[model samples]
Target: MLMSAAHAQVSLQDRRPVLKGIETVDDPRRIPRKPAAKKSKITVLRGGRVFDAVSAAARSATVVIEDNHIRAILPASSTDWPTEARVIDVTGETVMPGLIDMHVHLTYPDSDANIDEQGSAVDGAMRGTRNLRWLIESGFTSVRDLNGVGEAPYVLAQWSADNAIPAPRVFTAGHIITGTGGHATERPLTPTHGHDYAIEVNGADAWRGAVRQVFKDGASVIKIASHFAPDEVEAAVDEAHRLGLKVTCDCEGIYTEMAVKAGIDMIEHPLPRTDATITLMAKNHTASVPTLQVYQNVIDRNGGFYGSTSRRFAMTSQDDFDVFKKMKAAGIAMGVGTDTIGDANKMIPNVYIAELKWFVKGGYSLADTLKAATIVNARLLDMDDKIGSLEAGKLADILVVRGNPDQSLDDLQKVDLVIKDGIFYVENGQLVTPRHVAQPLLKPSPPETTK
Candidate 1:
């Protein structure tokens, strides 16, 4: 479920129901590993001013891609070009690491609706497949879905690999863990619904058990929602770390202090936080995903709770904005995310660009903002070693834009090409790979019957 950081609440003495049948096993099949395909093509993307995320500035260079990894980054004047490799000249463009969005929801496509509950599995799958395509075409090569409904994350990963879906590399936290009656609670609060979208536990022991279940269910990361007790948060973080998974929490309110104290690895929208809390987060080396775009979008399009509160926040003071600035100044690692849920037209790729603009408007340098979207986000996902930058030995996830984004952030919207895992997925702002279509098992009968 989507939540705004503005509605964060907590009850220190909240009691949890003692339920039975909380069972899980360390299933070996949890984390799927795709067998490496037969060696891929060796294609060298050349003659572009490369912006390796680690570099101080963009430089004229030639990137040599072999198989699925970057072989080397050579000076633009190098003469030793391999004859067997296919070289594509990307002159006059900025070649940088493919973008990464830190927070997203693949299961919920429409913000105005809950597709997970309203539609069939096939319906959700089709929407997710299409959304993935839209993101990749818009220059995002990878994203982390913060929450998903039941086995959807694993299923999506399998489809991308087993069926060769042309989509961004996806990482997911299978389900959000929240306290009983917390932000993500289902209305009826039934057991089936509890397991479907969230793990609503009570005590520290229950939190640990839920975290174990999440790992056993194939989540690469664990997410905890707002309103959790300090011990519960600590136990969740401890169990996740012990199990080799990172933990991120929804710090929509005062939970920021609790999350930081619990040694949480990342905080989603660690806003409405005091400078002391921001400083504390930096001291603890906790990363953050400030999904400011969601608030702005809500304010612009709807006057719902998120919209009204966001408006008030915007009008009241630059408090949150100043907090974000303090976060960056305090050396808190910030990653970019557009928590946009809705139709693809205005929500997707465009929302990501809007977030970038907000970062610049928030006083972040263009280079720092781009880094937050790329390498910084990659690091937040523990994928920096493979996919973050345009460096040798890294996976070749590249984006070529028409103009230098360093000079003007708007140039990012003009993506000329997108390359993921050494494959050219988009060229000249057009999709090039074969589309992945979800074939439903059951076809709709008549319109009336289907309804």
Candidate 2:
């Protein structure tokens, strides 16, 4: 009888002879492959002074991260970390929630006076990509882009998710909605060019239609430019609210009162207003994003950025500052925003530090200043649950700095490490990973010598 092919493939003398009911296996490649080992998802950050943001004091703690959320915040003296966890010793560092910028124009990257005119949509996208990476390494893990040109903001949002670009989590308002010829058009050289930053529509119906269009265009927030009719303002706010989107308005003078009365959720760069208007804004629970850094820049340039209006500039004009102080007294929420336009080189993270110092000068304590940048801003974005505080169960968007920001506002700029979604992006003041495009190191310029 002829032997089976399996028995014929093997040496008959080398193996036991195959019986009629037995089978022989000689193929080496047919051996079973063992399963690959699973990578560990647990990480432990030990020996850090954690700033919980809710309290005025820092405490020694160990933050245990499981996947993307913080699993536990144990006492620093505890030694209960899982043996499989990767531990990062942040001894002597100040660990706090990552910073949040309430307002920005990610697509606008020019320090020149004609920033709005210098870039096309494609150019803005490229520059925006670079800026986003810089923001993340600088400790800003999330941003609210109030006005972004074309599809740049939406594209950046997707890129950030795909890790095509290392950008902060973005909540974008695609374009500013304005009256036919308002603040959005005042600077752009031509009416057609104005569409780069804003869309012009007239009448209440037009305002409602514009709000719907922007929502369709993927805007999470609705930003109405200054100088719209009262009915238009009311219509925009009502429509945006109905659509479950909050309304933020760039308001000045009488329009500020109108916007507040119309139930607008936030006001940007609020113009100096009457006491009645300020009180009304506080009463209405409307928040403010004071882009004091840009205002101070205008003042520093001798008002050159605003032409004749530059001379009139002050860091929150005395009267306006007084009103804001009063509003603060009334429990109105205020957050910091740079609003720096032009280049990534010009609008570096230091601008944010400068803004914090101005807040300090304006009588905000270090704790309140930090709160404004983190918890308060997070609340403004309606993300207080998921971020803003170094609490258990929150996404691990955190910063480890060299010193206590509560001691010196300047320490906020000392970003020794940045972590987003439980992933380390910056360590030892350097970017260890670049998601898509590699970012070049940007060093600060030396102080100018006096003549």
* Candidate with best lDDT: 2
Listed per model in order, the count of residue pairs whose N, CA or C atoms clash below 3 Å is 3, 7
What candidate 2 gets wrong by more than 4 Å, as runs, is: 1-40, 113-117, 187-193, 304-320, 343-345, 434-451
Write one digit per residue (lDDT tens) for candidate 2, span 207-270.
9899999888777778987778777887888777777677788767788888887778888874
lDDT per residue, candidate 1, 243-301, as tens digits? 76788987555687888877788888635777778888888898888777676555556
Q: So what's the TM-score on candidate 2?
A: 0.82
Alpha-carbon deviation at 416 in model 2, angstroms: 1.6
Question: Candidate 1 regions off by >4 Å?
Answer: 1-40, 114-121, 161-163, 186-195, 302-304, 307-317, 343-346, 434-451
RMSD of each: 10.1, 19.6
lDDT of 1 at 114: 42
TM-score of each: 0.82, 0.82
